[model samples]
Target: MSTFQYLLGICVAVVTFVIVIEMLRRRRLRERHAAWWLVAGALAIVVSVFPQLLDTAAGALGFDVPINLVFFVSLFVLFLVALQHSSELTELEAHNRAIVERLMVLELKLEHQLNEESQ
Candidate 1:
């Protein structure tokens, strides 16, 4: 990559890392999720500082172009993140259902008690 491109990448990586940290500090993002983003941002900085890492990885993976490998890795990371969020959502939904069922049972019991006390 050219000097300009390297500088730009570094700038972007720094900004992303800062943004992730700021978000975490402000409680805008949960640690469970922000951890992955932080890792990505740190990796971005590392790759920007040592651009040869991409070249080496691409060559090892038999990719003719390094940029394609970057895209592939990014997409794979996003896929895993999406899958994890999907599973978390499923668990949250189950918990919500259980809570609602318990609330309904409690409400019925309370109503029965109130009716008996009135009689």
Candidate 2:
């Protein structure tokens, strides 16, 4: 292997090891989040080691060039993340509304009870 390839491989290995260690240390690296990063890292390592994989992926994805495929995939992942954020926001808003409504009902009941006791 060329010196550059060897250095690149070492860098990738170090990064992957560090990430895995971090995940273990945090103890919250659920499978869902880890899987995507693992897949992306693996794909990157594969492409770095075997350039042909990029060409094959590009051909399969019907992209005239390999970089286009990479960019498209990146954009898609970003969109998915945005969608997830929006969904979470909606759920939070709903929860807040429910809490507020419950609080209002409780306040009304307390006022009614107080009036009855006073009378």
Model 2 worst lDDT window (10 residues): 30-39
| C-alpha lDDT (0 to 100) for residue 98 of candidate 1 | 100
lDDT string for model 2 (10-117, tens) is 578558756865896697676555655566666666666676777898999799988898788767766776776688689999999999999999999999999999
lDDT tens string, model 1, 1-119? 79999999999999999999999899998898887788889988999999999899899999999999989878987887898899999999999999999999999999999999999
User: Listing every candidate in turn, what is its Cα RMSD in Å to the true structure after a full C-alpha superposition?
Assistant: 1.3, 3.4
TM-score of each: 0.92, 0.68
Distance from true location, Cα of 65 in model 1, Å: 1.0
- The list of candidate 2 runs beyond 4 A from truth reads 1-35
Residue 23, model 2: lDDT of: 93
Model 1, residue 25: C-alpha shift (Å) = 1.2
